[model samples]
Target: MEKWLVVLGIWAMCATCAVLFIRGATGGGSGKRTAAEKGVRPASRASAGDARAALND
Candidate 1:
């Protein structure tokens, strides 16, 4: 009985991990904020560097 309980706990943990992995694969929990949502233009690497340069002026 004790051994069975241990196996069940491990199985549950693995199943939970698999479900979380699948959800992430399907974009279920992405917390990324879009530029529109933040009311900003999409920034590229060059634009970011320009912004920093401007700030240093």
Candidate 2:
């Protein structure tokens, strides 16, 4: 009987999580910005020096 109570408690918690997950997956709240809207952009570069920082001697 005690074991069954624990199982039921776990199921209830999972169901609550599922409800919250579905709600979040659908709307995702109000305020959000697109990548392009941020304005600043970096040019693509292939040189290793561009990516790595040099230490001062």
Which tens-of-lDDT digit does each residue in 1-57 have in candidate 1?
999999999999999999999987886423444533564544543466767745633
Off by over 4 Å in 1: 29-41, 45-57
Top of the candidates by TM-score? 1
Off by over 4 Å in 2: 28-57
Candidate 1 displacement at residue 35 in angstroms: 7.2
Q: What's the residue-level lDDT of 14 in candidate 1? A: 100
User: Clashing residue pairs, candidate 1?
Assistant: none
| lDDT string, candidate 2, 1-57, tens digits | 999999999999999999999998976533432422463233332233533422210
The candidate that achieves the highest lDDT relative to the unseen native structure = 1
Q: Ten consecutive residues with minimal summed lDDT in candidate 1?
A: 28-37
- Give me the overall lDDT of model 1: 0.67
Clashes of 1: 0
